[model samples]
Target: MDFPTMGDLADKWLEVHARVPNGFMKGRPFTQSDWQFWCTANFYRVRVGAEFVHPDDATDENPVLLNQAFVYRRAQVVAPQKTGKGPWTAAIVALEAVGPSVFAGWAEGGEVYRCSDFGCPCGWGEKSHRVPAFVYQDGEPMGMRHPSPLIQLTANSEEQVKNVYRPLSAMIRQGPLSELLLIREGFIRIVGESGDDEADRIDVVSSSARSRLGNPISFAVQDESGTYTTTNKMVEVAETQRRSAAGMGGRSLETTNAWNPVENSTAQRTFEAKSDDVFKFFRQPPAHLSYKNKRERRQIHEHVYKGSPWVDLNSIEAEAAELMQSDAAQAERFFGNRLVAGDGQWMDMPKWATKAAKRDLPFGAKVCLGFDGSDNDDFTGIRLETLDYYQFTPTYGAANRRTLWEPKAWGGRIPKDEVRAAVEEICAKYNVVRAYLDPQFWETEIDEWASKYGDKVFVKWPTNRITSMWASLERFQGDVYDKDARFRHDDDDQVKIHVANAVIRARGLDPATEKRRYFLGKLTDHQKFDYAMSSVLAHEAVCDAIAGGALEEEPDEYVYF
Candidate 1:
């Protein structure tokens, strides 16, 4: 038998291997030496087709043959380096085109291995060459189709491996390839020396080989307790490298690619109070030295006493006393410093009593009148008082004396004309100051009063917003018991005392019924007062307005019937 030259051997090998079992030769097989010789010796004999091809013949004398050979000379085989484990790497290459004989030789040499057909006995060759033929050895294929490489590694121990691979196999058999890939890629890793138990140890060497060969391989290790202990570090590194490269071109890395510390630690500083500075949610307001430690109590007192815009007690009482005693004899009669006749009962009087016969009313005297209107059978009249009364005076001086007076005291409902006449007479007699008239009557009555009084008599529209009334009551209750303030009247002294007593009692009255009782007391008859009370109660807005300052005092002109 004659031994063939390297070129002849390569040609024969190509010829036999080209006719695959599938009838078409997608690729040809060559030994390492045959490949080298073909690449160098027949460098000019092969033709370069769209892919790679060997020409049928080559001759130096044939021009066409020379061109074809020249094309082949430029051609090169694209042999990618094996990447992963021996079995995985070999199985991937075997699926590509090299003939079964070459695969067998590679497998026997432990350089590569054939992977069995997933389920078909014809092997990958029966699958239209779409699946590469693989090298096999020792009755075991490079890779098995039923249990994946990861599953096989995990199945090392019956007790430890059973849990992981059993479920994994079930999932792979029933689930899609994408799902299987996820489970394999996500959960697989190699075992470190820390986990050397057969159940725990991972075939890291095999996994590393598969990774280097560009095979999609993953491995994971578990402890004897079946807890994952080792992970595929290469996969992590590759992913990181891929993300870094992508980010270099202004691509954003996925959130998963970002590194996060296993334990997050931070430092914080808190502010502490120094010797000079103190921390408090609220600071105390400035203190008045005289009132010093009693600042809060003093503030409450000031708010209660001086906060109102109307009815300044210090000024009004002084002015009223001075004015009433402007004429000496009239002063002697009016300010006699003793109780006399024709005096109306005073309400909200101070604790002290003094004769008004020698008292003098001062300038800028403000007298406020409170009127309680009556129905047909009730007495309709006004009560006048001075804001000039001492809020809390200890001295009982004549000029500073205070007095409250009700001029006309008729009981049964007087005619409107008669009420107007009496009001005019009282204003003329006492030189009346500001009068706040009750305006619960008909609008015509108010128009008449406004036309008559012009501005001196304030026709106050009733209201239920009783802030002023409450404020006035607060002031009166606070100041009335102070001994320095006094009340004096010549006639109807008892009535003045009664009025003062009534006011004192009423001060303690509850607000809901206070106004109604006030109106009832001022009426001519109880029956009529009851009727008027109903009307006043019905007109809550009007009553509230009067109690507030919504209505101003009218002018001081006289009114005709």
Candidate 2:
């Protein structure tokens, strides 16, 4: 109806720049006449990952038709380094500046956007043929109408503007759209006639950003957003832009490098944002891309970098290998496209998922419990491990699948009554051998559990003893990979999420040797891994029990007395 659909607009966009040879194409002039021959943007059309896809195309099975206008208000794309982030962003901005990006009204059947030059018989042909352009119906902006729009570009510094704004200006200055933009002092003015005007300008918002809170921004681009943390106030600036846009039904986009988790960057927050309005595109390395296997890692390197084919694989590989020697985490984050947790993430997500065991565990089964208590900020975890049971399967997807060790439970807050009831239920249903509780904010709950089930099961395993926790974590890592001593859990999102979020940090010296040791932690304060921590202590409980002595099944020598 509106034009063709969003796909057609994308098709038109690719066609329009079809002859605009990228620098990679021998730095040559437009030698080919066909739009496809001149540009590299269409490659995305052939193989677009979710991040690059149009918002209307939400699902592969049923992509939404983009006939009319429905520009998403906010889009946050967090990708690893060296992807075509800059090029694609530049292209999108240019299109919005002066292209058929907005919705015109619905078209009946075969409609075309006729060019105004009647003497020349000019027309928006082929790619945009039979597509609708914005037209007046009731003295309104038919489909997409911004007579004079202002777009702002903000980053950490003026220098950072080069990341997006420089390329953006260049694309308009050199590409077919050059005629429309007049390079002005403070803005690039887009107009039909050759003159600067307030109606349409793309401005680079200042770094201080104190006075930018209430500007009328039709579109805003926050570049290098990974650096926009709470302390920097860049995120607040972006939020202000979003608010400003909302008043005019405008929108904003954030282009960021893969953010550091501990930084709590706006990029990180956007990735974690769980709202329908906030669209996100975060393409990271698959967790299975492990450094342990060289060939696999190389193959995955090629795969993850598909979004940016211009990168020199040979150079990236060499640099990554060298970086791995000193900083594997950095290499992983920058090139491998993996989000690293300060070089101390406990386990790889794909590797952990490989250990998922789709099995059944019911009431009355013997299990060891690990409890991590939280009152408000954090969550409470009640983890159960198999009662030292194993099935020797030498050949499975994951070497030695933990047939019985399954992560079974979790709760949002420390629901005192519910937790007490859960502990009571656990104790009554199973032969609870060891229930290790960390008594932090949950002193009352831990004490109550000890009183109720202490005699039947082991109680609070002091986490303050840094030495013991260090040992427990060490054992747990070993168990994760020992194929013969594999760790596992059910396919519950909570368990998977907690496991993926788990981080390890070297903290507190061993009381005896005065040597620092690693303990479980979250990369960011907002990240949750208390559930996984509970599992660690629970697994540790079993380890300690097995180390001491197996619980002997009390002899059923019941003499009728």
Candidate 3:
């Protein structure tokens, strides 16, 4: 269900109080760009003053009030560089600090909002620009200021924190907001009756650990989350702030450029999370456009920076080209707003994403199976590939036809019976000609399968063999990037995540012969790559089946009904 928003009030409030922080339009009344307004509107959207009741079964006998009426607990915006994230964040901070940001109740009609009503000196009757008024319409949502707003402006480092902090200071100093806000050396305090009230202030929080980090905050702005990672402990800081905000019925906003997938940064994790309470806005350029091509790169820039008219396409192109001279992937990620992989990434994610054409395989289709197993501390899964090479896990099928199984999801051990039954069911439904089973920890199961199904159908394909595994990986990569490739996979989220998590690991030169080989490894110990391995084994089985003539076409016979 959707709710009415206080975006109109917020917009008008900023028009009277906020100002452009810097550049040629410095000190001018701030106006939101189209994208900025959209984000703000969605973030502020909230429920009316109504008690919670189950939509399926509701009764006046029992109703519960919600702790917070916000539709989203947090919001993230992923955009290109120089897209006005800084000034926009500063404006939001100011709004949270003094403006009517919280949902109050529904208005019947003929009500007006005045700065004097909230203890400010501004008024609508004043001939000057300090006064602002908001006339409420019938049934419109009203807004109220937080009594004590404690905001945190955070980033990976002190220098990065200035991205928002500097703009905030400038806006407060250059506008009517200066009358109510007291700009300090490291923070800004919202002036109260006694003046310089410490309870209502916006503080700069950087990567350096602070003792008061867990203090309950009214709102928080996480800047440049793309660089917040475990190494600097910024990820932990972000989590801490959110937990504190939840305690105070507050929310957070994260702003960043597109991130490197391999870094496992905060922005990447937030973007990939399956939580329904988080709002995300990322405008990516069309997939068909190539960032490496100069002409196509310009098109990408134009698309990503569409709403922000301040960004000069020519300037962006020149900067991207210069950056591309050394770091093309970073350039694309920063300017193209694309999720590009860093060094040692085994697969190109954009190419893989482009190949997601999921379709149902007809019943009784000739297929091959691949299995990778683990007892615990990792994933166990199976992948299926048709004879003509359309790969997918049976998870998309009926509940009983499970193919991929995770150990962590099954009480820290693989569900042996369920897996065996699923395999048995698949074998009965499809004409499975070949199956490659990695027999590292499941040798007994593999042997039993070989006995139940013919030995040729189920073979122990050990993956530790560097020579063979490397060759199979090479073949899979070739097909994925090939222009006329026949390989395609199901639109499985697990497959995509596992594939993205894989990194290249060198085996160095062979001891007996000076031969070099490489294999896939996980980016981190906790990140699993089993599904990717299963995919590689499945493709290898398809190749071996074709080589052995197991897929030879049979003559068709027609029978009249």
Candidate 4:
């Protein structure tokens, strides 16, 4: 007969079952045979394919008859899959008045009969693979896979087939099956006090494991005695014949939920290799060796020489000694021998200062002026100097000490109008080319001067007070020591020489407090003098610009009124 599609069959089954009284069996009184018949009839609606007819004399009195009836009926429903690659299925069957002994005996008896030459006419009478089995009574099957040697639950009775094997078979047929094999057993146990009469006796020790494999083989023993106990033991056995080929490095193997020995071993090996001290050298080398040796040495040299030596021992000391003994007479006589030295105090100036005063202030000559304003009865002063323009002036008394050029000053203090007037006069007189004016005293006054002078007057207002002062001083010192900068004046008596000497002397004085002390005896106020000193220190850029011949862009037009 042609079978209908699964959809059609399911629909018909649902309709027929819908008519059965729901929960009616709970209150109804029925014999076991009656219940069995009813269950069989309802199950028969589906085409189970197999014939399941009981013998004419089958009865509850004969255990064999009952077993036959149950097995036969189950066989019908335990139908083979139409596609044929699966295990059989069965229903749960309950038994009354059965014990562990009877359960074990039944299984043993069945096994004996099935394995015998004069086989009982059960389906197992023919040679067939022993499909796995599991039994459950109180609880539902845990849905574990087969050929799993570990059985989580079991019962000891002929009904064990219903409790165990039926569930096991159903589970096996459910696809996505594992290759692992499981052998298990089920049993029952009792507990409580001996004299209590009514102890908490219950089922226990329901499952056991027979064998396992993959990476490490394991076996389990489940005890159904008093407090149920399950113990699993693992043994590491090498896979000689089944060894994997070394593809890449490590072997890849299929796995189950259980621990795998091969993977653990491989992981351990990998960890050891990575953590070994021998590999550290390759990972990180010495920092010094990583850089180019010559480059590193060059960098060190540059840093050391960034600032020049503080004193030009060969020239400065010798010249200072020679000039120390001479007065204005010797100075003038020395100037007479030098072509560059001019008349006036320029002769008495230090050799360097004398040479500087003789130098020409051409339009493009590098020039810078530092102004000290008169504040609090202080005298305002302005100092000027040309950079890199030098002329030699001879000193007859100190013939061995040839003078170097130095800076000159054009400054003094009077009234605000006088300061302004003096600045204008200097700007006109000396072609006082470029002048820097202190902006603090009267910003408007300096602005007026700058307006009159145009690009010739540069108003310098200290913005970043401390940082600018420090940076300017550092640059000035650096340029001086490096011989990259020099004062442009004729002699030690020139305004430039006096200002430099005063500044140096002020710096050398020990302050009574942490703050620097400036004597107002030589100026109007200490603060203005300090500011003037800072401006002097800040002239390094002006000096460098002059020496480099770029002073026209912006001259150090610092002027004092």
Top model by TM-score, which number? 3
Could you tell me the lDDT of residue 129 within candidate 3?
A: 42
Residues forming the 10-long window of minimal summed lDDT in candidate 4? 94-103
Give the C-alpha miss distance for residue 254 in model 3, angstroms: 1.7
lDDT of 4 by residue, 1-561 (tens): 122112222222122111211123321221222222232333222222222223243355532211111111111111100101010111111011000100111111123222122111112223462322222222111111011111122222234324334433333233111111122343221111121212111121222332222222111111111111112211121121012111111111111111111223221222223222111000111212211233432332223222223223334323423543554222212211111112122112222222333543544333455565544344455555544433122221223321211111123334455455555544554444445555666577777777776654465545235544544554544443343455433432323323332322123223444444222112111112333342353264355445555644555788799
lDDT tens digits, residues 183-237, model 2?
A: 7875687764233455787778755644656877667778888888778777788
Per-residue alpha-carbon lDDT of candidate 1 for residues 378-443, written as tens digits (9 for 90 to 100): 345444444333111111123422222122333444456655555554454443344444566645
- In candidate 4, which residue ranges exceed 4 Å CA deviation? 1-366, 387-413, 429-434, 455-457, 484-487, 492-538, 544-561
Candidate 4 displacement at residue 78 in angstroms: 99
Q: Is candidate 1 or candidate 4 better by lDDT?
A: 1
Work out how many backbone clashes candidate 3 has: 0
Candidate 3: deviation at residue 243, Å?
1.7
* Model 4 residue-pair collision total: 56
Per-model TM against the reference: 0.23, 0.70, 0.84, 0.25
* lDDT winner: 3
Q: Return whichever of 1 and 4 wins on TM-score.
A: 4
Say what the RMSD of model 4 is: 43.3
- The TM-score, computed over Cα atoms with residue i paired to residue i, of candidate 3 is 0.84
Quantify all predictions' global Cα lDDT against the true fold. Answer: 0.29, 0.60, 0.84, 0.28
Candidate 4's TM-score reads 0.25
In angstroms, give how far residue 438 of model 4 lies from its true place: 2.2
lDDT preference between candidates 2 and 4, better one: 2
